[model samples]
Target: MIAIGIGLHNFAEGLAIGNSAAKGEISLAVLLVIGFGLHNATEGFGIVAPLAAENVRPSWSSLVLLGLIGGGPTFVGTLVGQHLVNDALSIAFLGLAAGSILYVIIELLAVARRAAMKVVTTWMLLLGLLLGFATNAVVTAAGV
Candidate 1:
């Protein structure tokens, strides 16, 4: 479920990338790829963090399955967005992604609360937000 939510977010990102490319903004497309690639690296860990917390050693196949579930949509969405450049559709996808990702965050927060690690979770959440802001600053500074 978490993977699905993240996948939806990545799909929206992919649409942005593809739309830039389709519009002949190759540089913007590349920039988006670089920025989103960095973001996706962390997202992969996020998709697996719950299993790590549970001390569950997922099988290699399961890891691959999760990767596909979480990352494959980017590729699929890129294909679709490249062929179909519709602002309304892109906006709809972004909205869905935001809602789904929010759901995932809420669910994870509940798990953290259940684990009685509110302090650690709160600090980690703050750190993540700071890092995300830093990343955005860098990407924005790069003129993306």
Candidate 2:
């Protein structure tokens, strides 16, 4: 489920990347890819958290499937975005991604509360948000 949420989010990110490139904003597109690559690294942790928290080691095959679930959409989204560029479409994807991520955050908060590390978790959450925003700042500065 976490993977699915992050996948949706990544798909939107990929859409942004593809849309930028489609419009000939090569610099912005490159910036988006760079920022998103960093973001994707963080999302890998999200996908693995349940396994780690439960002390359940995942099989290599399972890991591969989860990776595809979480990361494949970005590739698909880029393909779609390259050919179909529309503000409304992009907004729809972003909205879906936001909702999906919100659900995952809520679930993570519950998990953290169970571990009685709410304070530390809250700070970690804030740091994650800040990192995301800081990355976005770079993309925005590039005029995308």
Overall lDDT per candidate, in order of appearance = 0.78, 0.79
Candidate 1: the clashing residue pairs are none
TM-score of each: 0.77, 0.81
RMSD of every candidate to native, in Å, equals 2.6, 2.5
| Per-residue C-alpha lDDT of model 1 across residues 1-144, encoded as one tens digit per residue | 789888887887777777768868776677768767876887777787788788899889999999998899899878877887777765675566567667778878877876789999889889877876787677778775
- 33-134 in candidate 2: lDDT tens per residue? 877787677777778887888999999999999999999999988887777777787567557656776887887777788778978998997997798788
129: Cα error in model 2, Å: 2.7
Ten residues in a row with the worst lDDT in model 1?
89-98
The candidate that wins on lDDT is 2
The reply for model 1, stretches above 4 Å from the true place, is 24-35, 52-55
